[model samples]
Target chain A: MRLTYVFIAATMLLVHLSASGQSQEIPSVPLKALTGKHFDTVQFNERENPVILSFWATWCGPCLKELDAINDVYADWQEETGVELYAISTDDSRGIKRVKPLVNGKGWEFEVLLDENQDFQRKMNVVAMPTVLVVYKGKIIYQHTSYVPGSENKLYEKILEYSK
Target chain B: MVKKTGLLFLGLTLISNLSNAQISGSLESTGQRYVDDNKIQLDGEDAEHRYRSNSYLKLDYITGSWSFGVQGESYLPLSLLNYNPELKGVDIGTVYARYSNKKLGLDVTAGHFYEQFGSGLILRSWEDRQLGINNAILGGRVEYAPADALTFTFLGGRQRVGLGFDLSKGTLYGANIEAGLSDILAISTVDISFGLSYVGRYEDYEHRYLNGNNAHLVNSYSGRLSVSKGGFYSEIEYVHKGKDLLMNMGAPLIDGNKKAGNAFLLDLGYARKGLGVNASLRRMENMRFYSQHDLDGNVFNRGVVNYVPALTKQYDYALQNIYVYQAQPQYQTTPKIAAGEIGGQLDLYYKFKKNSALGGKYGTQVALNTSYWGGLDIEGDPETGMYTTKALGFGDKYYNDMAVEVRKKWSKNWSSVFMYLNQHYNRGYIEGKGGMVNATTATAETTYKFGKSQSIRMEGQHQWVKDNFKNWAAATVEYGLDQHWSFYVHDSYNYGLDKIHYYNLGASFSKNSSRVALSYGRQRGGLLCVGGVCRMVTEAAGFTLYVSTSF
Candidate 1:
């Protein structure tokens, strides 16, 4: 029995090591250079300003609300703390046509990127819509899933704290 | 030997550039154990165990203006992945190559890709892993944006079939155009957006059951408007589509005839300080949204939607969801089928704070929510055969719900919440495929936290009704050790609902990155309704284990 226990413990330790190894394997790719007319990437490490990368879909109600709330004060935030907000739309081709119109309809003035294939979503470990990630110098400082009415304000405060 | 040598050379090149590339993957597996009691079908084999597993690998290589990647997935137990056994070992995943430059954007995927058109009424290529749904298109896509607010896409491909099933011999072509009118118009407070799309498909079927054309066409249009100032915001969306509709009322009907449907959704909300209020109304007609034209023998291919209003009250209680409203396409015809037809739902939510001395150690927050859903009778009824011009106020079938929730935090590490719900469900209206009649239910739950890393949740729910299997009580206890490790146990007792109906207990353990759960309990078989569509799940004793993660 004791030997069996030892064997199990050893196997578990090996699994843990392998899992952690993958995290370390993340390549050091620069974000600023991911530029194309239809897509753009921002490096959290390269920017002195705090960064907000939000993953959303046009059909997701909570995601729309979160973006709308931020749009209301996005200009003010940009003026106050030089923050760069990047809204990534996970709208597949069927709904892709509405992204620009919806963004314009909301009067939102933020950088936008398209993850039509969910490539970035998978890389970022997004399980649900309206997932917000606050990054500073390429490191994820804070992350939150789902959104309530006033959650955007809390996120702004975190951004300010981190940027400072 | 030459091909192997070339692969070796490519592998060597990958290793040389390994320092600049990123590779990651994830694996998720689920297992189910079903125990059949001879209650429904006595004198037959009544127990089985099933297991399902799905995994994916993603690798990305980045260099300056270009990035390349591929994602591959495999599913087991053909049916679990919604695959027909006729086609074996045919994994329905994707592989792709992409290149982007300042002036051009190009994407070529040989395997599968999910696409959608505005609001997904006419087209929506998506995947819901939990539901084993993946509607990817195996094709190539290209996008061009000449201006900041305007974009366009051209795509051609074939839709994904079941896991391990080869793609059907069909081809689909589509295009989308989106523009922001606000950029050109002087709209300060009002934001307006519009989208237009067209999809054409060609099917090579051995047996053309529906229309002899062997070709399908769909046109979709969508628009949205929003106006916000101060703490008030209002937004509305409208979508319309024209395409072939498939109906399965028992006997399948392939309606190649042109059908049109539309939906309108409006939301208005206000919040300031600790107070919040929101109200919403939605009306939809003939909106059985699907991409395929000839979807025969597909159990879930019915396009009819269950209409439920987005009410402030949440029906999270298990009993409330048991007999919830589901959309029925067969009985509830859209305006296109019957003149002046309409269906809509309404919801309202409000929150309040308590500061009285009786509130004790901590202040309290309370919320109330209520919602109602019904259909409009516009034209002739099968029963009355009267074509009165006046519109019917509301259909006899409806769903009404009211709920209240309270929360309080005692110190930094402790918090608790209490909730109660009351619901009235119309079976005939909600469940299109008839079964039982109308029913009512009530439920309550509470949760408490011990610390940041440790917490416990408890729930008690009960329902009183006149139906044969109506009365029920349930309890659930859950403990969390950190965000990664947690365990939960729940049981429900249905007294005298049926001779075989008894109690069920289930437990689950999960880590942040992985999970394994086993449940052995008696599930009450009933109509699970959403939006107005209902699916019947059999009552059985079973255990299920599900695991998933990403690297």
Candidate 2:
């Protein structure tokens, strides 16, 4: 078993050296849209402009605040940068039922997907809620964790830098 | 010599092909150092270990349609207080390899995997580190999406219950199928979907109490339907479980105590633009199912086969969380012989338009939520262990909560949130002690942003209760130095009785996908919940360090 692990490690290292900066592709985990339609997250990379995936939950206070702040300026940002944002809810069965009503109640316009078992979250290596990532052509360019009061602006700045 | 040369060539070829693979992984470690304090003292084994840590590292390598991964975990010396004692030492916790082909409409996984079927009433295998519940299955799973509107899944495995791939004796098998009826029928006006699921658990018993009538297989089946048109939607689910042996205090009773279980859940919602309303009603009776029969009703929530979280409005403030509710789905005969619980919750969300009376210069968001739960009315003979319950009735009040919240932004630099809540918590029934306590709580939070990326937030909260822990007051202040750094100081005082101050101060730094946080504080011993699932944590004064990074 130890020798097998060594061999696997060597293969991973070789792959790492070859793939280097070109990897970081968005995983193709299966997901469900708020409308209950099947969705493949890999489709995110096929978009023309940079896409943002925000992992959040209905019960997380900071996540709500962050999304609300971004919602305020989302229209303007989209018109300017032609960017899109996907609010990926990691609410398991307990809270998954409330996500749609809450999102609609808040009047958020971003596309929403459900990660019922958090498979998409785990595949993305997200350890915490309110983790936002910027991807262009399936490759991650920027990411951030947690949220402060005025942190949305910094995120927008990164979006602008990547959009151009 | 010839075989060695062939093997070397094969290795070279494999290495060259894997060069196209991409690797991603994450690491998280949390360490704590306990301190001796007069107010809160550690006892027994807890005192023996002054330092403890829990760490996990996961690595995934993907190439085209094939991907592989492994998760290694370490709980050295000791894991965090309240964690499962079985989860000790370092070992490979989970391993998996998968092949997914979107074009072929097929996905297969061998090793450890997580899954959920139809709201997880019958089957759900997932992980929650905070709650110390990682019951992923170690076996095989296959998913086939033959068409855009139809999908089927099948799985069989043994549940992991401890560290280092430890598995439960009982074997689990499940099958599920979902169909989008609207799309198949070419109905454009409304959307309709349907699903069916079945889960079975098999275990061999060798105890003398067993009888010829006892069966090793326990089967559960579920049916679901959902319909939506425009902004209106509704979903309904029903589950029936075959008769199985009943357990009392983690031990199986006589075969005569075998009982069957069932559950019903309904959800309705309507939303558009600025207004949204949703309500959910659920009833569960003897619905607790576990991977291992002997491990039933365990404190660590291990070897669980389904997800049954409390349906309540999860609070954001510490005071509001004190009287949180946990789902009651077990049958008990001590003190009260109750079977299960029935309850529902309603939520309403409305946004006041901008430049209006309630909106001022900016819009204001208002949310109102309420929930109530009660025990199932059951009539039975304790000696015979036979019980009968009505389809719908409240035996005893378990919990109730009503809350209102408003969020507003006065300006670009200033924002605030205010909330008020009322609760009725039955301590005696829920926690096995004390009596009913009525409580009311209110909180206010305000944030002021200055400079380019700096902000300050202050919050005040107060809870009024006449029994069980009495009244409490708390306050918090957080300062953000920049986009990547922040500091916070929080204190919750039990002025009504204990006269103890649970003070905590913490700072965090984050850059990209990495975060580091350090804190020194007195942990308030109680149930710490995430996503409505909870774990009991002991009171302790300590310094904690947390670090996480992903690449």
Best-fitting candidate, measured by lDDT?
A: 2
lDDT (10s digit) by residue, model 1, range B1-551? 22332343245244434564443444555555555555532123222214444544333444544455444354433333222333222232555555555444333334455565554544556655544445667778776666545667778887666543345455677788766566557555545555666665555543344456433455555665655555566667776655434333322234422345666666666544445555666555555544344453244432211122232232455666665654332223322223222343333322232356534454455556566666645454444322332333554445666666565555534555566666666564444444344455544444444543465667777777677456777777766554434566666667646544445554444333344556665666665433222345555555566654443
Q: What is the lDDT of residue B510 in candidate 1?
A: 39
Docking class of 1: incorrect
DockQ of each two-chain model: 0.09, 0.49
Task: Show where candidate 2 strays beyond 4 Å.
Answer: A1-19, B1-18
On DockQ, the leading prediction is 2
Tell me the tens digit of each residue's lDDT in model 1 across A46-112: 7888888898875565586568558757899999999998888876532343444345434456877
Output the number of the TM-score-best candidate: 2
Q: How does residue A42 of candidate 2 score in lDDT?
A: 81
Positional deviation of residue B411's Cα in model 2 after best superposition, in angstroms: 0.6
Residue A13, model 2, lDDT: 47
Model 2 Cα lDDT, one tens digit per residue, A75-145: 99999999899999999877887888889889998999999899999999899878999998888888999
Give me the displacement of residue B448 in model 1, in angstroms: 3.1
> Taking the tens digit of each residue's C-alpha lDDT, what string does model 2 give over B1-551?
22332343245346545586667778788999999788988999999998998988777777789988778787876788889977776677898999999899899999999999999989999988888889999999999988888989999999999987789989999999999999889898999999999999998866556665555899999999999999999999999988988777776666536899999999999989888899999999999999888888888888999889999988889899888899998888777578899999999999998899887888999999999999998897877667899898789999999999999999988999999999999989988889898999999999999998899999999999998889999999999999799999999999998999999999999998889999999999998988778888889999999999887
